[model samples]
Target: MDKPEKGNPADVQMSDPGKKSGKQPVTACLICAAFFGALGSSFIYGYNLSVVNAPALYIKAFYNKTWTERYGQPIAAETTTLLWSITVSIFAIGGLLGALCVPIIIKVLGRKGTLLLNNIFAIIAALLLSLGETAKSFEMLIIGRLIIGVDSGIALSALPMYLGEITPRHIRGSIGQFNSILICLGVFTGQVLGLPELLGQESRWIHLFSFLAVPAVLQLCVLPFLPESPRYLLMERRDEAAAEKAFQRFLGKKDVSQELEEVHAEARAQDNLQAASVLQLLKSPAVRWQLITIIVVMACYQLCGLNAIWYYTNGILSEAGFASNIIPYITLSTGAIETLAAIISGLVIERIGRKPLLIFGFAAMAFFFSLLTVFLNIQDTVSWMPYLSYVCILAVIASFCSGPGGIPFVLTGELFEQSYRPAAFMIAGTVNWLSNFAVGLLFPFIQVS
Candidate 1:
């Protein structure tokens, strides 16, 4: 085996070590700040996607009122469902574009700048969504969703890589888990703000669009102070000393040397791998296999029915036979559960191994999916049956997020050789968002099927 170069764990040779007075212990404040920043990024992703589903109640209200008056005809549930699903999945379509843009964004803007640049898309889309809803144009909502989708894709591709790089190895899992936790936070916050009768009314669907602006502005405003990922600094710019100083400065108390060496080693080693052109990423055995792994992992993670599980909460609530008025409150309960699970998962990411958590989470989800299928199929009609499905589904959601949803993200950051990291990560994101679109589009059909 080839030995790692000094200043590099083994992969990249460009890391610099600035002498430190002493490594401070990782403080709660620092951890919270890192976790919160990462959490905010992931929340942007989850909120942009899941929050829209709640507004379907209002969107459907608008469509029903409009088509009924204009056409003197009632829209079929199937037709309504199809159109709504399209509107929901439109973001996924935008994501494909955003994910594809990751390499150029990272290369030109650097990771932090690329992430901050997404504020334009978020604000513009949010404004459009509000105007469209007020004007009663489905087209405007579609446009807004498409723009939000692009922002979502950008976050999905870059945020995990950002958090993964800045985090200490010993606590990478927990910090990485912050990604999922924040995503859930987004979903939860959206529900809380949107669930009030005033917010959810047909007159206020535009409010949902406005909700997104808060984060977009927050990210843009504070981003000037945040550090760029050391991996990007070291690998792309070949500035090792600056990278080490950054690690010490930002991470502040984590023994960054071992972790720093690993990151440097990983980057440098992959830098030496056969650089494949676009064609070779698809054709070369090693490159192709890695690309395929990234794609398949992303696909499998979504198809496991976790995201659809949350995004369709209102639909799921109706199926579970809950009163319409009370669903969001209950949905918030699940959100709380998810947040607690994420906090625990973050702590365990280091103490427990990644693969074990992945396997356990997957197995638990498969079990819950099976349960949901059976209870829904039997039409069991028991008073508690739908509640059982709801709770089980929440459990599966928690487990999937705690493990697979969170794990694949960190794995993607760590998997690729330096040159292709951006490309490889982007491809995985493309696959994930594409899968998300498919799931959102198919959900209504799946509900009745």
Candidate 2:
């Protein structure tokens, strides 16, 4: 494609980041596409968000109130605690493998293909869980979750990278904001169905795991249709004409020749530095600081133990002394509160800025977890205390939704130069997922102690 004379209309500078990325296609059609973008990864994040709570109840039932099950058998009280720890932490353990594989998947598969393949893992996991009914094998259930963790770990890092990279820059903040929205969507999906009012009527715990497959299937189908990341097409693959064409198509303009050249020029300068190795990432001060910041921010996001509540929502309610029958309702309420808080967050982001929101978010989170310790101790004496604990738990989730949950990936996508964004985010996100696995998988032990 020939470069347009320097003064092309599409060559003009964009004031809003959203406009820069792709805003002109804002009719009813593009809006639906945006929703599909949101829908794409909801389950990828949501499956992990909701899987933990319901199973813990059955595990508890197996070993009595004073104990918990291990490897499908009842265990002593001390071992019950260890058993639960293993069950939860296994998600993290599985994540270690997935995390290691992230760069490979994204690098080899390109952004879109890796995610589509990741969903295939989700389907197999659901099938394995459904098969658990016939075999009565707890191992299959844990292994199934481990596979999901592999997929989830990859998605947690890659989904936002994919979303952040592909969305209109102007709306990046809001769409990036949707990262948690979809995560909470998953939490909501799992919590709603897991509600004892619904599941209590029948033995349907399998329904929770089985239902997780639906979103994966949806993403699996839709992913092939959506445009692949323009950056990937142009930068990595060097399809100059196609990249410019994609950029123009995305912006809803035709004369993007200068923008096309800019894309090549930018990727060209950075492309030489694609000398990314684990050592290069570790040794370069700029890259290293970015990696550290990404990992720390992501780790802190999970350390609040949000997934503990999300994955094990029912278990959390039960521990606080909510009746097993009522836990799902409480979990759903958490989802509602999270949704409201996110809306308010979308409003406040422009005023608050990212760093301030993140710092305050983490500080508030540390305080809330401390409050959890106090509430758990009080659960022995005051029945009302459990309800307060539930309220506090939701408040913490709100803080996460409004703040840290969104910022880490957004900053990550921004901080690294375009050349390194994919690889850098891949590493940072792997850390995030592994940490989520740690906090979630070991949450039973963390809480018991």
Sum up the clashes in candidate 2. 11
lDDT of 2 by residue, 1-449 (tens): 22321221222343444444444553332333345545655455665666656566565444343223334444667765666666667767666666677777777787777778888877888888767655656667678878877777777666666666565555556667766677667767666776665653237777777776887778767767666667778777777676666555555667767556655666655655673766556656655666777778877877767777776676667778888666666677888877777667756775678788888777887788789879988888986999778778977888778788677867777666665565676677667766776776566665666
Off by over 4 Å in 2: 1-34, 37-42, 59-83, 200-202, 319-321, 370-372, 375-383
What candidate 1 gets wrong by more than 4 Å, as runs, is 1-24, 27-40, 66-78, 239-244, 253-278, 287-292, 379-381
Q: After superposition, how far is residue 208 of candidate 2 from its true place, in Å?
A: 1.3
What Cα-based lDDT does every candidate model obtain?
Answer: 0.73, 0.67
**Against the true structure, whose TM-score is highest?**
1
Measured by lDDT, the strongest candidate is 1
Measured by TM-score, how close is model 2 to the native structure? 0.85
Q: How close is candidate 1 to the true structure, as a TM-score?
A: 0.87
Q: Candidate 1 overall Cα lDDT vs. reference?
A: 0.73
Question: Model 1, range 1-449, lDDT digits (tens) per residue?
Answer: 43322212432332332223223356554354455455436777778756776777778777777778778998788778887888888888998889888878878787777778877888888889888756757778888889988887888788777776776555556677777788878877777766766476666767877877887777676666767777778777777776777677666644567646666666655766643344545554555555666677789888887777677888887877788888878888877777777777877876777778888988898888888888776556677777777878788878886778677887777665556567777778878888988898898787777
